[model samples]
Target: MNETRQPAHHRGRGPGRLIALVLALFVMLGLSGGTAFAAPDDAEKPPRAVWVPDSAKDLVAAMQPSWNLGNTLDAIPDEGSWGNGQTTKATFEKVAADGFRSVRIPVTWSDHQSATAPYTIDATYMARVKQIVDWALDSGLYVVLNVHHDSWMWVEKITSDHDNVMARFNSTWSQISTTFRDAPRTLVFEGINEPSFANATEAQKFQYLRELQTSFHRLVRTSGGMNANRLLSLTTPAGAPEPAFMNDLYTTIAGLNDSQLVAQVHFYSWYPFSVNVAGGTLYDAVAQKHLDDTFANIRTTFVARGIPVYIGEYGLLDYPNHFHPSRVERGEALKYYEHLNHTARATGVTTALWDPFSYLNRETLQWRDQALFDWIKSSWTTRSGTASFDKVFVPKSAPVTAKSLTLNLNGTSFRGVWQGGTKLVAGRDYTVSGTRLAFTANALTRLVGNRAYGVNATLQARFNSGLPWNIDIVTNDAPVLSNATGTSTAFAVPTQYRGNNLATMHATYADGTNAGPTDWTPYQEFNKAFSPDYASGAITLTPDFLASLREGVTATLVFHFYSGQTVTYKVTKSGTAVTGTLA
Candidate 1:
């Protein structure tokens, strides 16, 4: 063989039995006399479980709240590389504030190569990467560490031919897996970047995945790094991880079982304005539902197996970068978020908005987009509603009017509210396409544990009769205000606090269901805080901070504070179908 293959002593080291099957099968299969012995067939194999990732899903979500970070990282220098360490720290804070819980730092050590095969990554780069990671890890988020563009070796022809590509892929990951052997647990690693196998046959791709899957496991185990059994995330060819096109990848991928790598899928699905169709964007029911249905089942598929997930890359076109009609692009993004939020919750896989800074139009941050800083700081909150409705709501504004929608609480059957124009029903299901209001019939009552387990947290699980819910919350004509610095001129929570204010109140009900006010508080508590900050324009607080002050078992509290004369309710979640208020 013209290509030099590394020695075999560097294989996996663990108590698990070596695969007698793999070896026996290979031997029985009979190798051609000319077959290369040094580079075994398992060269490009990924680990047993390629679910764990070395990128921060949290940081990626945070940085480009409106764009995808992994793709973005491919284009620019990381924050610390351009300025003092403070810039990197500040960037982390901004990302965390944006609700990101991890970051994937792409390292191309080859850039730092100093005329050598065992290229050394610069200490400066490592320090900078570490600085941002420390911020993310400290902020209670996940982090991903991987060798990135530097894996270009896998891109060129294997020995300028077919055989060598296999050899290099394994050698590269082996070296990579070894290099980060001592990184922290939170830092996951990825094996490759978006790779293209243009010349490889479909059969070869199948064989390649299986071989790479097995080898990835071996390399991580051998690198003797934290990567062993660590969460790893793999990518689909060219970042197009559509299930329909890559279903076989899953069938073959299931064989490697290290239990760390989570299932991963990328998406950029479009219609009407892409490929064959020539028209305005399709942010309508067709596009939204397609995305909803596709991802919903994918999550269900992985959840059954107990694997976690990450959206490695996904977003609308980023400015000068064209996907379609520039006019309707923002709306295109809004529909995407709605579907992602509603569908991804059960899988515990949120989103990492893709925005390669220089690649996007900054103004994409219009309206109530959580993707932009101003929107997040201003009106992009978890909720908004009427002040009048704020003071105790009991099924007032609209009535249930859909067909067959179910209302369940805990584990019992109860009547849910539905509305068509203005009517309510008790035992029927109503479906409203535009705007409908609903309240779950039963609230999750606090749980009681076995006497053996004293002082346990309340059990808050909902075991409904497995029915579908289809009700839309009315968007109040009057703007909803939860804090002083609201984006719109109309809706702003007045704040007047002398140190004591709850930010959120988790309220459960008699029927084993739940609902909470984004800024819940006792009337007086609300007044005390709201009076001063009414004119200031912002209020922020943590859920635990709210839990600290309690009035009674069934009361709601808002955990909020005034800093520099401004109330900050930094974190929030919103619902599109909230009724007046829970009884």
Candidate 2:
């Protein structure tokens, strides 16, 4: 399905919805007399009954690959307020067509409902939610709808406001159950997204979850219609995949004795690698083990006990942080996704991508990176060969020499390398020894002809099976940085990358102590303390980094590059101003 293309067209636009808009406007403008007005009680049509009752295991299996509609309905205050486009049937249609079997619509209801007794959710918002769910169901995709941001918003207040919190939680689920009471079983209801209670101790955290999830279970069961047996998912505190949190969820599901229940958890890989801190720039052993162990534990804890687990959300923590540079490298991210999906399939765990238009563009309905998506889609059923890095850097100032890259066969055999339609000769142009793939100097010289400052050629390493690995031939030298003077809040050093890419930055004071906000590690987090603007030929030292420095102290900044080069520079903080000197 990812291979096909279709012309974009709007579909299933809700008719006569301007009245709902008028109601919302009145509420926003304080014209509703301080009480939110409910929409007309128009009898809603029931969804077409196409789902047959199935075991929780079977249901989760059918949801092999799922996608989340993140930052949209889940956005605080209101939908589309977080930069995502309005929800439409075409969104789900594209998802279903592109190989995602299910969709997770995270809805935040804090601002949409009343704060007092009955906790009345505005009828207009409820109907809009139903419209989106029905459209996904009609597109033949399973829908996992959940109480989204309300988790931290109000649900977490249970520690301080227990009575009122439970009241609102019960009322919210009661309305949700009644609305989808007759919908097909494909519509799964998740109680809460990442539930956590403030000021609660370890014992209280577990106790609070049991009470909250039990209430949700009871409310959905008594709502009648198909709701009596609808597949319900319960989550631990923060939806953490840790053993303690998962064990709590398992105990709760077992205590309920309902075969239609699912254990939900969210994973963002390892913290250091996830946020690209502490020199975790690569998906190394620690990061891979975190992913493997977490998934393996999920299998042993839930799947082994005849209980299904749904990884409600999984992705890098800083994935598609549109405002900053990528924390993880492109090839490294591909490896993470491939390993995650393959591991999920192996352990019978269902995973849903936590997408906030990070992978697919909501506006155009196209993948932001088709090749990256291809590796992900391929891993759903098979393995793809990858390498240590995606780029083959050749120094432009020197003669082209042979370059070797370690291959991550990923259980696949390497065939050869291809440049456009021409395949390089196995022995003459390139050679493979064990996992090492080396490009001969002759091959490098020919490929990097008239070497530019950026990528000069692209090569694809074809494997015996699955998708091919991409290798970019880039030309560059050690990046150059110039002295600069500016205030602590706005210091930008003139830089000329010369085609080389920054990997990490080390900051240390004259006394040899670590510098910057992250004092524990000399290597500062990418895009946090500092960021490189390759196109603009400037390196910006963020205010947070500068603010952490001591006045009159000179900190030596070492810029590490993926090309195995480092540029040293020194900066001294003088009260509110700072000066950078090229070392």
Q: Which candidate leads the pack in lDDT?
A: 2
In model 1, the runs with Cα more than 4 Å from the true position are 1-73, 76-87, 108-110, 113-132, 149-172, 244-246, 271-277, 319-327, 346-348, 358-583
Candidate 2: where are CA atoms >4 Å away?
Answer: 1-53
Q: Please, what are the lDDT tens digits per residue for candidate 1 over residues 291-337?
A: 77777666555545555556655554433133321323332343344
- List the pairs of residues colliding in candidate 2: none
Worst 10 residues of 1 by lDDT: 383-392
**CA error at residue 499 for candidate 2, angstroms:** 1.4
